[model samples]
Target: MAPVTSGSTRTRSTASHPGHPDLAAYRARELGRVRFRRALTLLVMTLLMPGSAQLVMGRKQVGRLAVRVWLACVGSALLLAAVGWLWPEVLFRLAADTTVLAVLRTGLTVLAIGWTLLLIDAWRLGDPLRLRQKQRLAMVGLNGTVVFAVAGSLLFASHLVAVQRDFITTMFGDGVASAAEHGRYNVLLIGGDAGDGRWGLRTDSMTVASIDEETGRTILFGLPRNMTNFPFPEGSELAAEFPDGYDCETCTLNSLATWAADHRDLFKGSETPGIDATIEGIEGITGLKINYYTLVNMEGFKSLVTAMGGLTLNVRDRIPIGVPVVDYIEPGVRRLNGFQTLWFARSRESADDYSRMARQKCVMSAMLQQLSPQTVLTKFEALADASTHLIETDLPASEVGEFTQLALRAKSQKVGTVSFVPPAINTSDPDIDKIRTMIDDAITKSEQPSGSGRKKGPGFSKSSSGASTGGSIGSLSSGYAANQSADLSKVC
Candidate 1:
């Protein structure tokens, strides 16, 4: 109603509202809020899809390059893993390369740095001043944690790979492995003792682990230390030396090491003359070609078992540790420590060597079942260190990958065993023909799938009359029930 006057004029500031903040100030506040939201969105995007933030926001060109590199990294990793599983030779060769290891260390470092920077940059693009102080700190803490976890995981994995590679390289070196014979890889396992008062490197235990390459089903041919008249493979150096089998009355199956050590000249150009000669003798006994040999130190065997966290054995009877300390591992489902386990597998005072052999087989089965991947990873360093002193093998580093794959496969199936001792055959004068027949039949039956008329549930075939059946083995007191079955776990 009052007339407008210049002195007392009423002025409108913005179209939206009068007497409010200036347009510029309001615009600034809105921009701040929008930027904070963008920053939040950018972080979430980067976390979900690496490089996506740069792809959609900051720099299109950089985002595209980052995306491509990320894809390549993923693809290459998957390919390497697949190859490692299929043909471990590739992995073995790569592991042997110092240059590759350096590259891996450097690449992981670069990725860790670059990844962290990108994540931090994504948060920076979010424009933190717009966010509350608490929100900004929270983001910083979360991103820091993520960076540490990712980087640490990559670095640790790299270190483990290197350690395992070094162990394989140092242990196996460059020895060439023999080809699989008749679709099988037969490795000679020898337990050697060279402590004080003992003859030089006398082999106390011998077992042939013959694995089928395809199915991974195994047949363990146990040769007694007292076995005599076992013929050597024809044309082999040992055979040429001992024309009528290794028939020294005092020097039987376990005496090969001392003899070979004494006559290294006979085994010319042999790195491990003792082990090689012993292998030839085993080949003769089992009628199977020996692919490789593993010599385990008996004294150090305790440390090896301890490193594996001990073994669980179904003790059939009271077993003595030995002379000075007459410690007996009592019966029932029990866990045995290093000292106790060694005696359980090797002691022969109360019982003869034949009984010791069966107990050893059960010990082997327990070790095979318990050495899982988790156990290896957790005790990786200990196991590797133990092996350096405890085991000596002719297995090649290059072929380790293949055998590793085979071993992994073997873990899932039933293990078949044929101990050529006692009631099954006469050890003092074993029928060489019958020994060969037993091994051949075991292998043949193993090749057939489970429940096939030829192969029952981890036991000898009902059809094969001469086969080492569980029923026939009952002639003994404890009964050779535990060791002579295809399924050692069930009997043990």
Candidate 2:
């Protein structure tokens, strides 16, 4: 056959081709290949261009893929447009939301890297579509696997960053809290029933969560709202270092909040009794040192669930919800929205307050469990928005990430939960020596380094007909169910 001359296209030479007579034929063949490749590249680009897949891939009769992409783009645009039109805060929030921006930035980086690799392959192969049907199938599978892996990794990293940032910003804005003295650390986890709009709502739920780094064990001591003690920490002897302005001598432990609210001015400034004084009062009452306190005032609870795509709860009993008893729930495990879960944890009318407290712990566990990379990616904007207004923590922002990482790592470990409810103590029991002893014993066990995945502690007896069971609080190790009961009522 006669050698064909080079057509209109330009061709690059390899190291071996210097002055071959068939260079014209080679150039022509190369031009034809270039034309085919350019056509194929355009076809691939169009196939992935969100609306031309059917036409480019000769699947006009089966345009589902193209239709799907078009629908996705359309849906996304409509959703964004609706958000921009109706709830414009979503848009404004995305703009100001640092967490959202960080996620977007990381995602774009990954996409850029993948596109770069694709371009390099096209340059070397000279014909991206040169693969036979079998090879193309294999390439598709391989490329898909790699793309998913990279996307998943980037997504997980972005989520961690956002969660940590939200936790940090909510806790320690810019101020630093001086760490307390040695062997005296206080951590408070406050559960509020804010959604119900109850007037003068005392802490709906309270747990003095303490961690002894030396022993590497965590202790969560439940505190009833009604335990009689000084209202604010600074007012008691424990708060002697701080100013003592309010007097809660006759008030119950729960009513201390009321008294503190009444004497708000006395606790506002740094020199005055603020959180420090409150912590002092708790220490004096429980005889347990408190070094840190975390208060989630109603709003935080709602925002957190909303950020977490809501939560799932094991409904202990059928309960009516909403005003006028419009909504009802059957007893079983079920998922709940932010408002529903908040109400479930805070409800005291349907069941005994003790049961409500248990539900509160369940809500907390479920909330933490639901958090993952996908959830964070979807709700990053919502979380970023909620973080600014909902939470209040004393921990430094930088440390918040570390704390969350710790919690995430410990996700598989069992968490022990105990409430400070004993029939031995009642409204009439002014001397809570037995209750205090139980708390102290439990704290000691929790502080001990866990061995064999078991915490050492005393057994608890259940009170029969309001009589003290006289049993010591029970001990638990990691991986125990949240509802696991060890009858601590035996003693009194």
Candidate 3:
């Protein structure tokens, strides 16, 4: 079969010879027209974008696209700048620096580079459609990034303050010191059954420890809860000043709770049973002006201990029998979980609150020791978690940091622990005056001038003449006994 030329080919053969110059010229013109139209579109689109510099007349499509991209870039840049200015933290945390300013600068740099590249791409592409697509994608990504940054910044700002506040609460807790002596800190470490249904509320154990970091000395005085004396300050005028409902009288400070419980009329106006008056009474008893006071209900203690991990304690003697619900703690060093520690603190069947108070002090001392840098680093994550849940205080976070720094600087510093128990200072009968004297002496001794050492000395020391022999533990009834014999090394 012969290969046939189509009818159009035959007509072309007739009209013009195969090597015609005019036909070649016509084909070149058509291709040129198409390219020109595309370039024009690019130019027009470029003009639509911000900054007409990219939209040259020749390449309409490419120029127009370049203009559109430039506009998008400019818009995104402005938005990012505003975000950085308004919510620096958005950039800060993403950049992850303690310094806020540094993070913002870094975010701005990233935004500028990213937008500049998008603008360049729009100019290179001659097709308006392609340019528009790229610009839209860039805009979406940029806007989304800024939105996430803003949200993150807000959350970061909120958490920053919260974390610091939590740290401060752990340090200066309860803000007991007055502004005049703001530098002076006092911890009224109390051991008590706080109105649990099983037992009425009363301060079972009280130890007023004064910390004069300025002088580098701490005075710890143990006050028996059962002592009978001028409970509501010593003077009659001061007693009269209290709420009339309390029925002002000289009685055992420990009895304040029992009395208040019996006479609910006294606490009618108050939500927190006579705490204010009780604080006043405490200051009067010790004659040491109190600046801050904190009342911790039972729940707070257990949570706090658990957060710090189980506390470490040196068991002085065999727990003998277990307090119901809580197990028997064997004699020796024991790592106690939160529930165990609380049970150990509250167990009065085998020992009185006086002994309990000593145990609490021992636990506190152990806690301080465990809070060292070595311990902190070992369980930093847990410590941080526990800290947030278990504390309330007025001291600022910065101050807490300062204290931590101070503590860390003196790595070799010694923390002395004492419990005022049997044989240290006897309280056979409710001798309020005698107890007061002992507390005063302990505070005075702690604050007394010392050499390189800043810790509290031995709780009780015999004078040169030596006093009369003290009575045996069996003879003492309802008398105060403390674990004054201290092995000071365990404390921080």
| Top-lDDT structure, candidate number | 1
Top-TM-score structure, candidate number:
1
Reference-based lDDT, each prediction? 0.74, 0.51, 0.49
User: Candidate 2 lDDT, tens digit per residue, 1-492?
Assistant: 986756432244432366755776777677666655554564355324532434444556434544564566567769889987896545544543456657655754654454434433332243435644554555456455644564556566556566645544554655464453344345777554454542234555677765544332344566666565333343454355234322445555554455555566656554323344446556655666665556676645676777777776556456666655667666545667777766676665545555555556655555544676478667777776675565556665434433444444334333455555534345334344665686667655554555454322211112222211001112122111233332221221
Decoy 2 TM-score against native = 0.57
- All candidates: CA RMSD (Å): 6.4, 14.7, 14.0
Model 3 lDDT-worst window of ten: 466-475
Deviation from native of the Cα of residue 402 in model 3, angstroms:
7.9
Clashes of 1: 1
Pairs that collide in candidate 1 are 39-126
Candidate 2: worst-modelled 10 consecutive residues by lDDT: 467-476
Sorted on TM-score, best first, the list reads: 1, 2, 3
State the lDDT of candidate 1 residue by residue for 34-152, as single tens digits.
Answer: 66677778887776666889878757877777777778888989999999889775775676555576678667777766777778778777767667676677777877787778667
Return the TM-score for each candidate structure.
0.79, 0.57, 0.52
Evaluate model 2: give its lDDT. 0.51
Candidate 1 Cα outliers beyond 4 Å, as residue runs: 1-41, 77-109, 123-133, 194-200, 302-308, 337-340, 377-382, 452-479
